[model samples]
Target: MARAETRTHPDTADAALLEGGRVGLSGRWTADQGAAVEDAAARIAGSAAGAPILVDLSQVSRLDTLGAWVLERTRAEIEAAGGRLAYAGAAPEHRILLSEVKLRAAEPAPAPRGRLYGFLEDLGKRVVGAKSDLVTGLAFFGEVVTACIRVAARPGTFRGTALVNQIEQVAFRGVPIIVLISFLVGGIVAQQGIFQLQRFGAQSFVVNLIGLLILRELGVLLTSIMVAGRSGSAFTAEIGSMRMREEVDALRVMGLDPIEILIVPRILALVIGLPILTFLASLAALAGGGLTASLYGGMTVDAFLARLQAAVSLHHVAVGLIKAPFMALIIGIIATIEGFAVEGSAESLGRHVTASVVKSIFMVIVLDGLFAVFFAAIDF
Candidate 1:
C-alpha cells in the first residue's frame, strides 16, 4: 500500500495537491483546528469545482467530529458546484466516524425561489387563509347557535352564574368608558349640528338632527365599536390562553363540549348585555346633547326635551336597540373563533386577540350597513 504523502501547495500552505487527481489533507484537524479546517475545506471545495476529485485524509494524524463535519461540508459544497468527491484510503477507524458525521451533516438547503414565484406563492397562501377564516367563522356561528338551542331546551343546564359573570365583565365593567365616550360623541354631534343649522336659520332643528343621528345610527355604532375593542379582545385572550394551556382539551376529554363550557355563556351575556349598554349609551348621549343645546344653542332644558321628544320616536330607539343583539352575536362569535384558533404560544394569543377585535369591528360596520339597507327597503 502506498502511504499518502502530504505537502503544502507552493502558493497556499493550507492546501496541497497529489497524484491521481487526489487532494491531500494534513495536520491535527481536531476541534481546535475548526477555523483553519473550515478555511482549508473551502479552498479544497473551490479547487474541485466543475471536476471530479479524490481526497486523501490518511495524512491527518489526529481528527475529531468537528473536523469530520468540516470535511462533510466541503464535500457538499463541491457537489453543489457540480463536482464529485471521493475519499482516497481513509483509515478504517476514521471511515466509520467520517461516514457518521457526513450522514448527520447532510442537511438540505432551502431552494432559491424567484421574486415572481415568491409573490405568487404568498398571494395564494393569503387567498387560502381567507377561505379558511370564512369557513371557520361560519362553523363557529353554527356551533354557537346549536349550543344556545341545546341549553335553552334544558333550562337546568343553563349556566346562569357564568352568564351573569360575563355580563358584569363585558357590560357593567364597561359602563364608565361607555358613558364617557357617548357623552363626548353626543356633545360633538350637537355642536356640529348647531353650527350647521344656525347658518341655515334652522338652529332648532339641530335638536332633531342630534336625536335622529344618535338614536338611529351613532349610538349603537359607537357602543359596539367600544365593546368590540374592550371586551371582544378579552374574550379571545382568555379563551386562547385556555387553549394554549390544554384546558380545552381537558374539557373535551372529560366529555364536556368546549363551546358549551367556554362560549355559550359569553354569547348569551353579549346578547343580553349589549342592549342594556346601548340603551344606557343612548341616554348618556341624549344628556350630552341637552347640555350642548343649553350652552351652545342657547336653548332651555325644557325646550331641548320637547324638541327631542318630538324628533325621536320609539321606532328610532327600537331600531338602534334591535341591532344590538345581532352586533353582540357578531362580536362574540368572532372573538370565540379567534380564541379557539390559538396555537401554543404567547405570540399566537396576542395575534388572535388582535384579529378578533379587527374582525369584530369590521363585521359590526358591515352588519350595520346591511341593517340600514334593509330598514330603508322595508320603510322602517
Candidate 2:
C-alpha cells in the first residue's frame, strides 16, 4: 500500500489546470482517509478560474467507497463548469474495486417548502373569520329562541319526534363516558389534595378539594369536552348533510323558520342538558373521590363525607352549573354556524365537522379561562 502524495505538474493537460492545487489526492488516499481527499479536491477546483483539473490517484494506497464518492463529486463539479477532470495512475487491483463502487451524487433539493409563514397567516385569518361567525351566530340565536318560543306554544309546527331523538342522542348516549371521565378527574384531584394536605396532618381535606374543584372547574371542562366530541360534531354533520340534501332550502320554501324548527331546539336541548349532566357528574365525581380516599388515603367514608359537606359551598355548585349553560350555548352556536357554513359536498361536510368540533372545543377552553380569571378575581 502506497501513501498518497501531492505533486503539481508543470506541464498539465489543459489551461484550466495551471493555477493552484490542480490535481492531487492529499494524505493517505484510502477508505479511512474520509474528507481529507475531498477537501484536497475542493481546494484544487476552487483554486483555478474556469479551468479543468485532473486528479492523480496513482499513489493511492487504497480506494474505498468514501474516496470514490469524493472523486465522483469532484468530477461532477468540473464537468458542471464546462471543464474536465480525468483519472490517472490507478493500481491494477483497484481496477475491479473502483469499477464496482460508483457514487451517485444527490441532486440539490428545491427551496421554499410551500411558503409556511404565508400559509399560517392565511390560517390565522380564517380562524379570526370563523370566530366572528361564532359571535354572529350567537346573536342570531336570540331570533332562534324567539322562534322556538312561538313553536313551543303552537306545538303543531315542527317534527317533535325528530327533535326529541336528537336531544336524546346528545344527552342520553353521552352519560356513561361523561361519568367515567369525571370520576377519574375527581380521583386525580383527591390524590393531589391528599398529598398537599398531608403535610399539615389534614389528609381528610382531600374530599373538600375534590368537591370544590370538580363542581367548579373539572365538571364544566369535562362536559365541554364531551359536547365538543358528541353534540358539536353531530350538529355540524346534521346541518351539513341537510345543506347537502337541500332540506334547509325545503324548510325555507315552506315558510318555516329554520332557526326555530332546526337550530333552536338543539341549542335549547344542550343548554338544558349540560347543567343537568353536570349536577349528575358532580355526584358521581364525589362518590369516586370518596371511595378512593377511603380506600387509599386512610380516610373513612363518613369522615370524607363530612369534610366534603364542610368544604363545598352551594355557591360553588351554582357557579359551575351556571357556567354549563353558557358553555353549552357557545358549543351549540359555534357548531351550528360551522354546519350552516358548510358547502354542499361530502368533503366540505367532513371539513366543517372537524372544524366545528375544534372550534367548539377551543371556545369552551377560552371561555373556561375567562371564567377562571373572573372567578378568581372576584373570589367566586
Candidate 3:
C-alpha cells in the first residue's frame, strides 16, 4: 500500500505507433473489443505507408469465445484497411474453427436429375394401364345392353323432356357442323368419283360411287372422328372433374354404381347419338352430291337421286349402323377409363382428356378395320 505501482495500458500506447503497421493485445478481450480494433484500424488506414496490423494470439492461451471473436474481428478490419494481417502463430484449434465456419457457410448441393427419363417412362406406363383398363371395361358391355333393353321395355325412359336436352346436344348442336362437313366432303368425293367413273364412260355411276362410299365408310368414320374430338373429350373432362372433386367417391359412398350410373348413360347416349347423327350426315352428303352433279357434271337432281338409290345397297346401310354403335362404345369406354384414371389435379385432367381423344380415334379406326374384315369374310 505504501508503494505506488505504475502499469501500462498496451492498447493506448500501441494506438499511436499502429498508424504505420502494428497491433497490440496485452489483456483478455471480449466481443466488445471489436470497436477498439476497428477504431485503431481506421487511424492506421490514414497513415502514410499504411501497413497491415498483425495481432499476436500466441499469448491468448485462456481465450473465451468472445475473446476469440474479438481477435477474428481485429484481423479482418486490419486486412480490409489495405494492410496484411498475418497470424504470428496459429493453434490447431484455430484451424479447426476456420474450417468449421467455412463448412457452415458453404452452399447446398443441387438435386439430382438422373432419374428424369425413368420418371417419364413410368408416366407412359400409367397411360398404357389406363388404356388397358378401358379395353377390359368392355366386359361390362353386355350388362349395358341389358340395362338399355330394360329401359326400352318400359318406354317411360324415352320421355320427351329427358331426351330433348340430349337430342339438342346430340342432334341440333351436331347438325350444322355435320351438314357443313358432309357437304364439302361429298363434293370432294363426287369430284374424285367422276374421274374414275368417267374412265369407264360411266359418269352416271358417280352417284352410285359417292352414295356407296358415304354410307359404308364416311358415315361411320367421319361420325366417329367428330364424336371422338367432341363428345369423347367431354366425357373425360366431366368424369375427371368429378373424380377430382371427390364426387365419384360420394357416389360410391351412396352405394351408386359409377359404371351403371355414369358410364352406361354416356355410352348409351353416344351409341344412340352417333347413329342418328350419321343418318342425318348421310342425307346432307347426298344433297351435296346432288348439287355437285347438277352444277358441274350436267346431271339433273332426279337422275342423281335415282343413280344413288341404285348404287347403295341395304346391306351397306345396315353395316354402317352396326359400325356406329360399336364406334360409340369404344369412344365412351376409352373416355370414361381416362376420366377414372385421373389423379386429383388440373394437369392430370387435361392429359387424360387428350389421351381419351387419341385412344378413341385409334380404337374407332381399329374397330372399323375389324368390321370391314368381318363383313368381307361373311360376304355382307
Task: Work out the TM-score per prediction.
Answer: 0.81, 0.64, 0.62
lDDT of 3 by residue, 1-380 (tens): 12112126543212333222444334333344555544544443444144655554444333345445444554555455665655545467754553343312336796666688779979999999777765667655666666667666866544445445555665568878887898888887888777778788887888887888889888778888988998889889988999999999999999866765676667767878899888888777878888887877889888887777777778888888889988988888788878998998899999999988998898899999998999899988
Candidate 3 residues lying further than 4 Å off, grouped into runs, are 1-135, 139-164
TM-score of 1: 0.81
Best model number under TM-score: 1
lDDT by residue (tens digit), candidate 1, 99-153: 8888444459989999999999999998898899889888888988898889889
Better of 2 and 3 by lDDT: 2
Stretches > 4 Å off in candidate 1 = 1-31, 42-51, 54-73, 76-82, 87-128
Give the deviation of candidate 2 from the true structure as CA RMSD.
Answer: 14.4
Q: TM-score: which is higher, 1 or 2?
A: 1
Q: Quick one: best lDDT, which candidate?
A: 1
Worst 10 residues of 2 by lDDT: 10-19
| Total backbone collisions, model 3 | 0
